[model samples]
Target: MFINYVKGLLIGSANIIPGVSGGTLALMLGIYHKIVYSSANLIRLKKVKEDTIFLTMLSLGILTSVTILAKIFKSYILDGSTRETYLNMLFIGLTTGIIFKLKQEIKTRNNNNNNSKKITKYFLFLIGFFTTLSLLLLRTYNISLDISEYQNKKSIKYHIVIATSGIIGGCAMILPGISGSLILLSIGTYKEIINIISQLNIIPCTIFGISTIIGTGITILIIEKTINKHFAKFLYLSIGLILGSILQMLFTITKLNVKPTLTLKISSGILFITGIYINRILESTKK
Candidate 1:
């Protein structure tokens, strides 16, 4: 139980950081499969007391860690434009690591498949890539889900966006190489959701939080079935989503403070390296 709690903290910490994949971390921690299976069963109201306890401990840990870390990260975002730029660079590096790790996994598993299957995989990859890119581009261009100007948080559009963020973030949290926070950033609610936590905005935060839980349950079920039926196909699409988002992340980083002192630049570079090294460490330490 204690171990589960600690694992949850690490996983939650990963999800809050843009470009960090909680699913990958969970996989490294030797609990991804367990958690996914348990979550799906819990959703079905399985009578197993053990799964309930496992999920409860993990959830408690995740909630505790996210509640604390979101405050710290929100401050980082608020500190200065240059600081935010540095964080973005770190995220880019982290994302690059995920890409490499997935590439290795896919390459190793691509054996025993013929040309037609390969073609289908590539097609699915393109679908995931383009779908993700297009959605991200919509947010980047302010065409969707930018409800920052609304004072009343109860507006239908605001709720819709928040609900959507929760659903997306939740599902991403389970997908290897996919960053829940990055998706929220693309949706432009990353900070707002953080603020809700930081400020203890109860109703909306509760809604979002609950949505994430529900989404995770549904996603785990879907992913487990999909993997059983078509494992490589899903990974291909996920890789596409990862690749497409990387381009937008670069663009977003470029939009940040373009002029930084040498010190900030160097710090950003180091953070980038550290991010990559973190993933490398996770990859090497896989369980």
Candidate 2:
């Protein structure tokens, strides 16, 4: 239970980062399937006791981490400095470690399959990779969210837009390699929403929260069904997205002109190994 809480914390924190996906972190932590299964089964009331307890703890952890980090990020990391670059480096290491684990899982699962099918799966992997890479690159240029409109009108239209964006962002959150905040950014509501969160605005935030819950519930149901029918292919696609995310991070760092000092490089290397070691420890404990 404590371990699950920590994992939840990491996932929540990852979600706050622009290129990081909470779902991907959950996958890396070996809790993604369980989370999806539990969420999907929530309405059935079967295994109610266990599922409820697990979800409750996980939710608490996520909430705690998000709230704390949101405050910290707003206060310190918003300046777009080397600190943010260093932070991204650490997360990249963590992501790379997870990608390694995911590859091994894919290989083990596909070991029994035929060569042609394996080739096809690899092709699907490439498709997923390119798909995600394109999206990230496009996001760099597009400004979809109209914050001016949001600020000028406090009418039903504003509320509806916020709710709709919340739903979309919530759905994105469940998809591996997709960042919900990025969805909000694409819609141009990311800054406004963050301001609302920072100010603790009640009405708008409440509406957004409700929408997110509804979206997450529906997404969990859909993904659970899909995975039940097509686990390997889905996993391959997920791996591809993960790989794309890693590349995107490297790309962003290069674009930002973050000079990698020797000490920073050494620290990053240690953090990368540590991330792998921690993942292995978590998997072992689960077994």
1-287, model 1: which lDDT tens digit per residue? 89899989988887887656687667556687788788777778885798999989999899998999889877766354776777667766777787777777788987857999999999989987786577566656766455667657879877777788898899888976567887787777888898898888898888899899778878899987987788788778877876775665566566665676798779988988987898688677764
Candidate 1 structure lDDT: 0.78
Candidate 1 total steric clashes: 0
Winning candidate number (TM-score): 2
TM-score of 2: 0.90
- The true-versus-predicted C-alpha distance at residue 267 of model 2, in Å, is 3.4
lDDT of candidate 2 over 34-130, digit per residue (tens): 9999987786677888999899888888877876887787778744666666677777777777777777877787656788878877897998798
Clashes per prediction? 0, 2
TM-score of each: 0.81, 0.90
The RMSD of every model to the true structure, in order and in angstroms, is 3.2, 2.2
What lDDT would each prediction earn against the true structure?
0.78, 0.78
Residue-level error in angstroms, candidate 1, position 284: 2.9
